[model samples]
Every structure is written in C-alpha cells, then in structure tokens.
Target: MAKYSDEFKLKVVKEYLTGKIGLKRLAKKYSIPSNTAIRTWVAAYKAYGNNGIKRKRSKEVYSVQFKVEVLHFMKQTGASYQETAIQFKMNNPRLIAKWNQKFLEEGIEGLQEKAKGRPSMSKKSKPTKQEKEMSREEQLERENELLRLEVAYLKKLKAFRENPEAFLGKHKQSLPLNSKKKDSD
Candidate 1:
C-alpha cells in the first residue's frame, strides 16, 4: 500500500466534494491507485472534517480505557472492525480486531500493553493499582483462571516425573501417557 500525504488526500477530497467530478475521473486525474481511497477520504472528511484526512502515524499506543470504550461501542452497535477503526480514527482496521481478540480472551487486562523487554521487577511482590481496585467478580475470575493454569502445570510436571521417556515421546502434544501393552487372553 502507498502512503498519501495529508495535502494530497485533502486535494483529492476537495476535488471530489466539489461535485464537478465523480470518484473514477477524480482518481484518474490525480493518479490515485484506488477509487476506494477517494471514497474513504470523502467519507472520513464528511464524518470528521479536516482531521479525518490527516494520516495517522504507523504505530500508536492506545490506553486500556480507550480499548474498552471501542469494544463497548462495537458491541452496542454491532459494528464491523473497519467501521470501528474509521469511527475511532485508526488508519488500520486490524488493530481494532486484534484488540477485540485480546479483550475476548483475556478480558480488560489483555488490552493493556505489556513491557517490551525482560522485566526488571517481578509482578508477584505487589498487586498493580488496577489489580488492587478490581471488583470481586473480576478478581475471582482472574483467580480461577490462574488456578486452572496451575493445575495443568502440576499435571504436566507429575507426568514428566512419572514417565520421563514416554513424556518425551513424539506424541507429547496430547499428554504424558505411553501406550499401555494389551494382554491377550
């Protein structure tokens, strides 16, 4: 995909908005690759005015509250990812989709951005402010997920201790068990 400067996009949008030409002719005249780009620009301009035509930076950090608000609006309106991104002024719609996936799998906690590299501090020493303020239901859900994970880890550890050879078998994908021998009558 090609990047268009705000000036170029605004020019195309202004030409289209003049009512003197349609999108196809305007795109050809301006040498824009996609007529869809013009249409999107027009829609964005109409919806958000000059700011809509301005290009967003390639990468941005969104707050968890912002992510949650977007998700809630999406749920309330049943809007598609593209629609949500447009409404929220995001250049790429896939971001809203990834946020939605994280929200679904990990709840609001998943929306927060994690540290990029190795952590200097351990999370176990103290609860974060967010954790401290968590509602009772939210806390229980988090604890439940943690307990389930711990159980699975213990189960795997037990299997590894019991049958190191079978556990390391090619089908380790399933569980730690080796095929038991069948006794013939």
Candidate 2:
C-alpha cells in the first residue's frame, strides 16, 4: 500500500474537482492504485473540504448538538448503555461511560471525543509477580514430569535385562534342546 501525503491527496481531490482529467489518467499520473480511491477522495473533499485531507485517528467528533440530542434520546427513552450504543452505532462501552460521566459532570462537553492517548485511568490489569512465578513453576513441573517418565522407562529396561526370566516368565527354555549324548556302557 502506498502512503500518500495530505498534500498529494489534496492535489488529487483538487484535480478531480476541476473535472478536467479522467480518474484513470489521474491515478496513472500519481501512480495511485485504483479509481475508487480517487473517487472517494473527491467525494470527501466535496463534503468536508480541505480539512478532510487530514488523517483523523478517529471519526469526526460528535458535535455538542449531536451529543445533546443523544443525551436527550437517552433521557427520554430511558435507554441503557447497550441500547444507546446500538442506537448510536457506538461499540466502545468506555466511550459510552465517558459520555455518561461527561453528561453528569461537564454536560455536553464531556460527550466530545476525548484527545487520543492513553486513558487517564489505567484500564489494563497487570499480572502480579506471584502469578508470573507460578507460571514459571508450572512449566518446570511439566518438564520434570517428562523427565521422571523417561527415567522410569530406562530403569525398567535395565531390570528386564538383568533378569530375563522375570520379564519372559515361564517361556524360559531349560537348555538348547539339541544336545548329543554318548550311549551308557
């Protein structure tokens, strides 16, 4: 995939907006992969203007009015977080929580998308040192079990060789069963 700069994207959008060049020619000229990309850029530029060219880590922030509308919906409908999430097409509960908290604290301002970074409160649970040590111990126990089985197998083989009759049981022969004998005088 090629990473076109914001400038390159704007140029393409500008050229497309002029209606002077075919999408194929523009794509070929800029070595863009597909007409689809050019078309999308043009559409975005028309809708959002130059600001659309800048890459956003997240989708466009919900406006204060939009947030208020959602809050109103939540209040009027008495919808739960899940219901609101489904209605608004938002998947993140954290985002919903933030919005709820914001509604309670700063009202509509909290509903605005927070700056993209690590959350103020650490949400990830770290493994304790004891848990890490236990995992290591469990791994060692598995290895020791395998070693014990191997040692037992070797010891059994040695014992069988030392006393073949014990291993073969009653199948042991009394002699070669083919011996020459002299006649008695």
Clash counts per candidate, in order, are: 0, 0
Clashing pairs in 1: none
**Cα lDDT of model 1 by residue, 1-185, tens digit:** 44888988998899888899999999889888879878878877877888877766454666554565567557755787767767665655667889989978986668767868786876598877876767666989877865664465457557656775675453334321221222323
Could you tell me the C-alpha RMSD of candidate 1 in Å?
A: 19.7
True-vs-predicted CA distance for residue 104, candidate 2, Å: 34
TM-score of each: 0.49, 0.33
Runs with alpha carbons beyond 4 Å of true place in candidate 2: 57-185
What is the overall TM-score of model 1 with all chains considered together?
0.49
Task: Kindly give the stretch of ten consecutive residues in candidate 2 with the minimal lDDT sum.
Answer: 171-180
lDDT of each: 0.69, 0.60
TM-score of 2: 0.33
